[model samples]
Target chain A: MISLKLDKKLDSSEGEFLLSIDIEIPKYSFTILCGDSGAGKTSILRMLSGLMTPDTGRITYDDTVWYDSRQKINLSPKDRGLGFVFQEQALFPNMTVRQNLAYALAKGQHSKEIDLLITEFQLDGLQDRKPATLSGGQKQKVSLARSIINRPKLLLLDEPLSALDQKRRMRLQDFILKAHRDYDLTTIMVSHDAAEINKMAQAVLSLENGKVSRITRPGEMKKVSEMTSGTITKIDESAEELILKISLKKKSGNAFQEEYATGEMIWVSKKM
Target chain B: MDWQPIILTFRLALVTTIILFFVSLPLAYWLAFTRSKTKPILEALITMPLVLPPTVIGFYLLVAFSPAYQFGGWLESIGLRFAFTFPGLVVASIIYSLPFMVQPIQSGLSNLPPSLREASYILGKTKISTLTHVLLPNIKPSLLTGIVLAFAHTIGEFGVVLMIGGNIPGKTKVASIAIYDEVESMNYAMANNYSLVLFSVTFVILILVYLANGGYFNQISK
Candidate 1:
């Protein structure tokens, strides 16, 4: 299990925002940080990947302390054995595809793995081509292949498929899913797309206003749907009171309505 | 035709270009990446030699490196001499042609995306390795341009080499200095021969540069 307890204040020249998040991710599960832009979703991943230092935090993977402010210990991204795939694809334009993959493989740790990755990612014929010559989808695939060539313990993807078209996005998503299954990686993906979140995330963690407001399990949606259906919710403007006539069927359904006060904006949807 | 000066000029240019390649790489790297408060000051310093008259730089070098100066005295104590020597001429040429070496490299490094460096860092490569294996290879064309420009510029340098090296034949005399000497000594025929050779050499270099830069010469010729 990887436990991350981050209570940090992020203040650039822009302004100060507090990020307090406490979450435990079971090993080998696909976790999604689902939020809108500017919600500090990428910031969290940056912290986890050791790209950004938090003001205060303790992040531990199993028994290893990846970061601990009290102890003044922080591992670098390379030492942490984490792979990151940036949204920009970040391929080295000078290197050929084979050289790029070989760069990630440990020194003297060569095998048939590179050829396998090239073939697996459908980059067989494009090994000699530079990143500038490759298409957007091809570049992203190369980036993915390069990141996973080392078999990192964790994979941090920041909007990996967001740059592609819809068809390419779906194709890359399927590739990611297959890679995740094959490696059983502890994966953390950041995405604003709700459909992507639904398809890939075993647990959805929503970040709002620089804080993780919700960490819901997969089955919570069924219960939320069941509860929302049975409540007769009314807002009384004179007293500013919310009245919920909760019957048995209404009790299981419209639970979010019960939890939220009347006149407070909430998204109501039927069970999908 | 006496080929000694021609050989001497090529040697000087080749040495100057090689030395400038090493010197300019770090300068270009810092100019491209650093956001320090001193960056603009350093950049101005590097470009100052380009704007100033070569005679001015040569005058300063002659004074600072003369046998009477403290630095020159110290260099003499270490069994080294600077003024009126081939090495002195090289030093003067390098200073004279620094901008030609640095500007192209600086532009190339600046135009490169920073994401490439960040990606190398993320892949666990150290800064030195990233520079050697990643950044340098990507900027190969710029390095080539810098070398060609510096070499050609150094080959044509006259004022600085004249002031510091004093046109000693077969010792400190390069083609440009020799050409001046020939014209001064009423050897117009030899001067013209030297001029033709120098012109052809320079023309070929310019042609290569234009062709490498993707047919700019063809468009201009048209």
Candidate 2:
């Protein structure tokens, strides 16, 4: 299990606030941190990855002390042995896709694993190309692939698919899920997308009033209100069950409740 | 016509550029990434050469290099002398041209997305490896600009070199000094030759850098 009691002073345009949370995540669980923008979701991921330090806190992951306040011990991200994929892709612009994956290889590790990753991620054709030459989806895929090259046990994903299109987002989500299970990773992803949370997370933590609280499913999401209007952008009849793809005013998610047709206006209410 | 000055000038420029490249890499990295309180002070000091006259630095260096001064006496104890010498000229040139080498690199490093470094760190790479393999490779244009500007700036130097290295033949007389010497002796033809070479070479060097960085060469190659 991974446990943390983190305290950090934060600044937003709204003003200064304290982010304090005590949380435990079971090993190999796909946990998602859900919150609004500037709600300190990314901050939590950064703190967990040792990218950001928490003020006077203790963090331990699976028998290893990642950080401690009194003991004054903090492991560097390099020694923490985790994979982090930033929203920006953050691929080394100078390295080709193959080299980018190869870079994450630990000292004395085999190079053949890079080729396996390339073939697994279906990046074989693009392996020799630099990041600057790749499309947005391709770059994100490469970024995700490069992160797990070392087969790190912990993976931190910060809005990894937020920038992609609807189709690319789904494809990238599959890639993430595949990596998550295939590598037996303990994953913590920061995302506000309800459908993503529903699809990926086994346990969800929502930040409210500078604190983290548990939420079971997307049904309890504040974003899905008591009643809302949306146009049915797509109606998939191919599946055994009918699925309506509705585009709401502020956000979009699949409304699996009732049968609907394309271009139909419908009212969506919070089930609970 | 003594070609010794021209040869010596190129040699000095080469040496200064090489030394400055190595010295400024770590310095620029620190300036770009450090949260230290002394950063502002060091940054101001590095940039002082940009605003302050070369003679200001040259004057202090001249005094420091003189065997009469304490700093110079220590150097003399080590069998080194800087007053009116080629090494003195190199020291002066490096100080005068420091900003040219450092600013480009510092800005380049600062402008890269922080996530790049963080990603490398998460991949368990040390700072040095990340710098050489990732950061430096990504900022090739900035490196080229730093190297060329430092080289050209050293070649075009006159004031600091004149103060610390007073026109000693085959020792401290560089092209700029040679141009000045030729013009003072009414040898306008020789002066014009040196002037033309400096102007043309610097112009070509600058144009080439811009073209390469602008992706003109890439376009052509494609």
Candidate 3:
């Protein structure tokens, strides 16, 4: 388990606020920090990765103390033994994809791992190309692959897929999941997409104004399945198909989907 | 035309530029990333050469290298005399061109996104490796600018060399100083030859830097 009691004063778009938290992250679990913009989500990940220091705190992984303000004990990021993927792709622009991965190799570590990563990410043909020549999704994939070249026990991602399109976003999510399971990593990611949280995270820490407002399991999927109904506003007579506008109740927060309806007279529920 | 002065001038510039490249790398890295309270003071001292007259620095070098002073006396005790010598010209040129070498590299380092450094650190690379492999590679244009500026600045310097190195045909008489001596003796042809050579060479060097940095040579990148 990684336990931390952190305190930091930060300035955001809305002004300054104190980000205080006391939380213990379960080992080998996928955790998500969900919040609006400027809610200290990314800052928390940075603090955990040793990229940003807390004003006062004790961060411990098992028995090793990562940081303690009073003891003056702080580990450098290199010693923290983790991987970080920034919001934007942070691949070395001057290096080819293979070279970037090779550069991340530790001493005495073999190049076979680099070859495997390139194949795993489906970047085989693009391995000899620089980052500037790739698309946004391709670049982020390379960034992810490079970060985990050493197979770290921990992974930190800050909105790594926010810039990608829907198709590419889903594609990268699968890659993140595979890496998470392949290494059994203790993953901490900051994201605002609830569906993605539901698909990837085991637990979610919803943040508001630099504070954890709630710990919610992302089971919005179950709720949506239970109460989904939409008025059949239009019917296509040519194909003998009914068009269903599946908007649930106003209280369900606007769950909507369109589907090709059958001609059966199915009873619509009052709650839906 | 005697080529000794021109050769000596290039030798001094080359040596000074080479030394400054190594020295400025560490200095620029610190200035770009440090939170030290004394940064402003140190920065001002390094940049003094840019605004102050070269003769002001030249005057101080003369005082420090003279055998009458304590420093000069100690230097002489070691059987080393920098005053009016080739080594003296190299040292003075380095000081007079310090800012030219440091500023561009510093700005290049600062302009890079912070995530590049943080990403390298999180990947389990040390500070030195991160600098050499990641930070420095991304600032190629800045490094070129610094080298070109320092080399050209040292090549054109006259006041500092005149004060500290004086005039010696094979020892301290660089092209700029030679031009001055030639013009003083009404040797306009010799002065013009030296002047045109210096001008054409520096201009060509600056043009190459501009073209390379502007992506004119970037055909293969895309």
The digit string of per-residue lDDT tens for model 1 on B1-222 reads: 889999999999999999988988898888888879999888888898888988999999998789899988988889878899999988888888888889899998888776677667777777788899888888877887898989988888888988899978898888888888889999999999999999999999988886867756558898
Models ranked on DockQ:
2, 3, 1
Ranking by TM-score: 3, 2, 1
Query: Which stretch of 10 consecutive residues in model 1 chain A shows the poorest summed lDDT?
Result: A261-270
What is the CAPRI rating of model 2's predicted complex?
high
Query: Candidate 2: which stretches are off by over 4 Å?
Result: A217-272
> What TM-score does the predicted chain A of each candidate obtain versus native chain A?
0.79, 0.82, 0.83
Model 1: per-residue Cα lDDT over A1-272, one tens digit each = 99888876776455787888888889999998987677788788888878788888799999999999999999877678878888898888878999999887866667688998987787989999988899889898999998888888888898998877755676687778878888879899988765567557888899987778888777764544443333444433333223333322334243333342111212222244
Q: Name the docking class for model 3.
A: medium
TM-score of 3: 0.90
Winning model by DockQ: 2
| Ranking 1 against 2 by TM-score, winner | 2
Error of 2 at A238 (Å): 16
Provide the overall lDDT of each model, using Cα atoms, as 2-decimal numbers: 0.81, 0.87, 0.87
